[model samples]
Target chain A: MAFEVKDVLIVLPAFNEQASIVHTLNDIDKNVPGANKLVVDDGSTDKTADYARQAGAQVAQLPFNIGVGGAMRFGFRHASRNGYKVVIQLDADGQHDPAYIPELLRNLDQSDLVIGARFAGEGDYEVHGPRKWAMGLLSTVISRSANSKLTDTTSGFRASGPRAIELFAKDYPAEYLGDTVESLVIALKSGLTVSQVPVAMRKRIGGQPSQNAWQSAVFLFRAATALIIAYMRPTDPANEPHGEKS
Target chain B: MTYFIGPILSIALIAIIVTQLMRKRLRERHALWWAIGAITTLFLSIFPGILLNLSSWLGFVAPLNLVLILGLALMLLVNLQHSAELTDLENKVRTLAEEIAELKLEDSIGKVNVSDFPESN
Candidate 1:
């Protein structure tokens, strides 16, 4: 079926997800037919690029592991440069469902960013203890920055309009936890309209999940620091098409 | 006269800096600044009268005290300068890396056809 959004690219950013790369690509192909799919293999030590290529998705092999921020930036650059009108990012570990791509694209008409939030009162997103507290704190901070309530600030499943594509293609955050926190901060601060929709997410069917509890705390601290910098530092006024909302 | 202490400390420090420079561990650009620092300290230590006159002009208590204070301040300035340069270089390197990574991705994924690029239209 031909999509209403003609120039839409499904971007799957993967790193060492050899076990589920093919499966992820298959889901995109089955769900979103006639869509240009690009798998950004972020310097995976395994044969992720080869598997993704065999699975019939265009493969962009990074020279080294540049983290999710770098990989996503690469995908965005490819989409922006290629004249793709919209880009929907999906995680490679089968955790992100491809069914919500249409909803995200449709919402892109009004907002520059449409996030597929798992905890948007639609599904069960379980967390406990300090991690839950951290998520709540992050959600509050991101909501204020975005000028809209965002339940899942860390959700990788999101879509971007031309303005966001242009911004990210030029410069995106490349830090430990900068992908989600710093990128959102830039989008909101640059006066881009940001919104979220409820979407159910799946548990990782395969592949190793990076980050331990200790590492997660460190990442939280780093992401929080990046958020502060994004707020404090003055961005180029000309780059921001929509004037500062705050 | 604070003679033995000054020469001994500065000489040891200068010796290490020079050795590092010779070994290519320190770049010529940074070596020049360290060399200047070493010479300034050595000159001030050897000539107490010069420091005495300089301190009197600056309204410091004594040349012996001024030498330490001035040297410390100069070193701090040098460190600050190095830090600024390092930060500039780091930013440049990071930008270059991201660009290279983007270009490499384009190459491996699909070489962008300039004619197909939307900007041309």
Candidate 2:
């Protein structure tokens, strides 16, 4: 069956991404035809919100910079409220390829959550060495604990259907770790299907990536603890049978 | 001199408890760093000569005050980050609440619209 573009919404959680937001928006518009774009500008000091809006995408300008997790929560809530059947999360840094969106969305038909896994295919991706090691170790631990097959648990590019959106909208870990591992764990515990599709990642367009050496170490420590807690805690209320009224 | 040790130990115990209580309310990320900072300060306080020697290595003219200020500043930054996080969480909660209200309204409207239809035979 052909996918309906109107049912899909692209969410960009941007923070100080003025230099790249326009390009990212244009790329998504050109590639993902008819898919509505929503850019949640996380209190950018530049013209990120203006440029995104002018580029023919919806804009949600936050009052302050709430980090990536906070921005994503806002995007998820917006997507849920606006009746979007599937919401694809794309980074504002222009590192993600819009052409691969169709592939990610395709997997959504079979899975509740579809992630763009950069490590799945037989290709050389330019991920930083330290980050790769950390992500590998983290994903391994998370997959083993959650009883799920996860290759790239730290990738930001993900597509979520309504079920996934409802689960995320209620309780998402809002921090620097992004919605990678946390979302997968939630989906699995909720009995929702989760899968990954191979997609190549590129170097960021402008500005430095958020994870520096110090920050990455900090994130690893924090995310590991959060993951353990998430694994122990109950899934969101919506995930439970009695809580599925929505 | 012996009596001084008792009061110092009491003060140290009180400080540790107070810091731990504060840590409980902090976000996990900030709390970890804060705990580290508090423990380090407590350690240096118990062994004041460590700061004095480290300061000499760093070429600080007066190591005691410098070390104390630096530790305080680090803790302050962590506190600031925590405050910012709380504000962000508050805003997010407000936004989620508004969205929930809207969703409930739409759901009720849909229910009412369905009820308005005529009864089937």
Candidate 3:
């Protein structure tokens, strides 16, 4: 089977992001022309799906409000079923710079997974207080478990090759299971090459941030605990056998 | 009247046993705490005088029944939270499984030969 390199799909997960979905779509169309864009509207009560569809992107409306993890899983399934050679996860709140889409896509040729590291670049952007603390705790745990340096364990901007899309589409933690960080760990443990690319992040365009101080604290505790459990759990054969295949 | 104590104790023991059995299906960490609360309630109910001194010290405002009820309420809240957590986890697993199936199909397709299809003559 011949695979075309042009079969890359950019997936955006949005929840009640009607305000910024249009701008996010425009940025992707402008920055990554000809690349297919998919928006997973996670049961947004607002007009998120309508605006996303009007913005010239395919939209997948979940039946209920699944978190970021669920939305991403939906997008991954769409990308996989449609035969996308590469899948790029872009945030719908416009914090991720779509301009770096090319750079992320370019890096995927060398690595199975390429993560856009927000903390890797020079520019300064405000990190939400709760997210900052959560990231700090997660980074420490990931560094210890994977024995790999990860500066931005929680950044939503990421690019995955066919291999990664397959792995994540299968076992991606969908509910408060530390999706991004856990995916990274799974990819590394499976011997899939992982790399980080520096990308500039912008402030959110609209809508209140998903979590407040109390919610963020709770999320942080849950996410950190999930990561710890994942680290200690026995590795499944499906994940380990891939290493032998490679 | 003295024999009443024996039947009350037996009923409390049965309640405790039933709750312990039900705890196996409950995911909340507070179930164990609630069990403790129940046992405490039973003990205090059997010997009402044990709480008499404490109740008097608090001006009888902090009645023993109020304390037991509060503990039971807390346990109920925790159990509710646990149920919510379990539901969330189950939903996550269902979605994950669906996504995984889709990806596996894509992976298998990559290894197949599409050229086998005949071109128009």
Candidate 4:
């Protein structure tokens, strides 16, 4: 698929990333050039929305923090409405290196969804403590479910094709599990082909991750349970009120 | 005694819920469910034998245990219902926020193309 600025929309769901959003937006403009850019400022109390607006990306200012899933949903909706064929999800924190965006989009030729998996080939990302263990457990569960080799179940850097975009725009997990693990599960179950590309992520350029070590531990447990429940839920077209739009 | 304590507590609970419902502080749908709960507790408290008999049929040996377990189960269901309602409200708030943001952008950019959307609060 040829990457066109008008045809591709890179959605960065940001929360309190005022310091990093401008840099992230700049990277997209510099790296991808023609891809339309959008920032879903997930109800940041900080000036994240303002900074993104100033940076010239179309901004969707969420009144409050609605988590990544809700923000991604809005992103896909904007893509479908504005006639973009490819939508890429990036992090506002600048961890997701925009340098690999071309490779991710290229892989979209073989897959409906392309995720920038952190540990796929291992460049330099390190994980230890309870966090490492949680990722390992999640990787195992998600890989087993998706029936594909996936190294990073939590990587937010991803690309979506038209089919994946419209499905998510109607309904995506709006909370903790929706952003990562369950999203892939829902996509795979809904008949969208998913693949992962090896990408080395950079460290955060601004604000801390949404959760600390302790909160992540709690989140890990909750995410595991939600993933189990989500598996039982088959993505039925009848379940959604909206129908048939790409 | 069960007479003075249980009935009075149930009546008091029902009265509070009823007043809230009448004042429109609580939704009628939710209040109706709570009213059923208050009335069930009142009935079970009045005729403890009904619970004891039902518990025995369900293979429970202790009536108090049955009462407490049932009460806990009902409370859990109510909590689950609240969670569902909360999730719905969260989605609504998000949609409203995004819609307003889009409108603000259109207004500032002088596009004025969003007249189709109903004005949202």
Candidate 5:
């Protein structure tokens, strides 16, 4: 039962990323040849969908912007329906290198979810101020919840197997900070095994970084709130370990 | 003269409610509660002795305090219901948006409106 590259779906959630959409698609093709590529256009005003279609990736255009959480939920449902065994979420800004797709998928053999973590000694990526503090605290708290040490809980680059895919497609949170921060909590709480691999992050090929200094400061508060809510959520039957449906 | 103000205000509220209902600006389900409240207030205002007796029975030292409390409680209930409805709508909208994207992807084959199918490499 060997897994083929074609069985993996690489999902890129792009928001007004017309500048780098084509380049990112080509990079994925070059790195993971024959792998299926899907670009969920989050109501980009620019020509992101057009460019992605031109570059040979399936484009799912959302009618309006619903953030990355909404776009990724659509992606998971697409993968689940289309029979993709593995899903790797990569950023459209080209910050995530496609070279690590194989490494992530390889880890999926043993674990249900694999995260391409930035702070795990692979790259010299650094954060400062409130953002750094928030990341550190989140890693500590979530690592305890998952019963394993996770150095990067907020990394967007991750791979999900069939179990994680089924759960996420059914109940992925669509709130602010829900995609990255809350998704990890949901996966771990649902009795899925989670692991991380170190990967170097690159500068965006185009478009501005979404966060500012003020946002980073506010991120500390928002991230904490999101975590509290995730923890306090009534345990859903779907979130329980498989076959324990109540 | 001042004692008549309460009855006049209650009558104005009832008139406004009826006008809104006739114009279809408010759903009957929502206006039902407001209409009942207005009519009750009108009855109590026209017969102050009834309000006085009820407030005394309810152990209120002043009838005005009872009026204020009832008004506050009604507003709180309305606000709470609105918040719940808003959350429900948000969830529905998210699901619809996702379904729309899914259907568009399905309808994309042989359609020129969406992105062209990438040529087989």
Candidate 6:
């Protein structure tokens, strides 16, 4: 499967990342030039949209701060409408290397969605405390659901082929932890295949990690709720009327 | 005092619901639930013996306990309904926002194309 850059859209769901939005765009241009790029501004109060537009990528400014899940859903809808066959979701903070984009896209030949797994023996990215435990628990459960061993289920760096793209364009969850953990469960339940490739995590160019020690302590409860709800949700997303007008 | 407070509370609830309906602040669909609840409360307050007999028949030791549990159950149902409605509204809003952004991008791209091609009128 020869995947062309022209058939892919790099979706950067950014929220107030004015400092590094330009650098992220430049990195994509340098690494994957001619690939379609979209920056969902995610209701940034900063100049993230302006920077992205100036960097020559298409910009979609959401009317409110709808979080990463909502922003990525917007990207999927745009891709679905615009005839893009693949979408690569990269972090706006530059922690995800654009260089691994090809490797992710290549794995899409075998699976509907390919996750850029950090802990899959590729990156030195380390997490401790309750956060690591939560990630391990989530990955163990979700891996079982997917019927495949998955090391890092919470990594935002991922690529979606056409099947996953179409499903996500309509049924992507926009809740807390929905974008990563819940999303994989939905994909697996929807009969879409998921695979992962090892990628080294880079230091974020700017902004702060949203998680703190207090939040990590609360992560276990939230992760469990999200996973349970994801599994309990109707497998046929169309039944829920996610795309129903009015 | 208990009878007086019951009637007063039910009346206040009904009054607020009515006011909201009149002001167009609450939809008829939503007000319907509260109206039924307030009317039931009013009826029970006026005829306290009915509740006393019903509670005993329903295997409750005290009428007040029955009232408290019923109220709590009603509140939980209402809260659950509100959450369902809210999730629906959020989904709708997200779809609309995405649509608007996509349209704007298309419009801008169209404008850029027209300018780039000077010969195209």
Give a tens-digit lDDT track for model 1, residues A1-246. Answer: 122556888888888888998998898878877788888877789988889889988887766776788778877888887898788899999998888888888888889999999888866767665556667778899898777889888889999888888888876766655778778888887778899989987889786565567766765676567667877877767567556424
User: For every model in order, what is the number of clashing pairs?
Assistant: 0, 0, 1, 2, 0, 0
By DockQ rank, best first, the candidates go 5, 6, 4, 1, 3, 2
CA lDDT, candidate 1, residue A107: 84
**Model 4: residue A34 alpha-carbon error in angstroms:** 2.7
> Interface RMSDs of all predictions?
2.6, 6.5, 5.8, 1.6, 0.5, 0.9
Could you tell which candidate, 2 or 6, scores higher by DockQ?
A: 6
Best-performing candidate as measured by DockQ: 5
Give candidate 4 regions above 4 Å deviation: A145-147, A209-220, A238-246, B1-16, B41-70, B113-121
**A1-246 in candidate 2: lDDT tens per residue?**
235899888989888888899999989979987778888777789999789878988777666665677667767776787788888999999989999899888888888888888888834674565566677777787667546567888889999888888878876766446367676677677877777788888888988756677776766677677677767887556577345464
lDDT by residue (B1-121, candidate 1, tens digit) is 5567877778988999989988999987878777888888787777768877988999987667776776688789889988999867855655565566666656555675444668867
Error of 3 at A142 (Å): 3.0
**For candidate 2, lDDT tens digit of each residue in B1-121?**
7536634764675576567667784345655665666577667667778888988888889886677788688878878877998878876675664344334334443633434448722
Every candidate's lDDT: 0.79, 0.75, 0.74, 0.82, 0.89, 0.88
Cα error, candidate 1, residue A99 (Å): 1.1
Q: Write the per-residue lDDT of candidate 4 for residues B21-77, one digit (tens) a residue.
A: 889999987876788889999998888889878999999888788878877888888
**Model 6 lDDT tens row, B1-121:** 6659989999999999999999999999898878988999999999999999999999998889999998898898889999999999988998888877776777788843434556755
Docking quality level of the chain pair in candidate 4: medium
* Local error of candidate 4 at residue B31 (angstroms): 2.3
Candidate 2 lands at a TM-score of 0.66
Residue pairs in steric clash, candidate 4? A5-A34, A5-A35
Q: Which ten residues in a row have the lowest lDDT in candidate 4 chain A?
A: A237-246
Per-residue lDDT over A13-73 for candidate 4, one digit per residue giving the tens place of the 0 to 100 score: 9988988999999988888776678898888899888888889888877777778887888
Q: How close is candidate 6 to the true structure, as a TM-score?
A: 0.89
> Second chain TM-score per prediction?
0.72, 0.59, 0.50, 0.85, 0.82, 0.86
Native contacts retained, all candidates in order: 0.29, 0.00, 0.04, 0.54, 0.96, 0.62
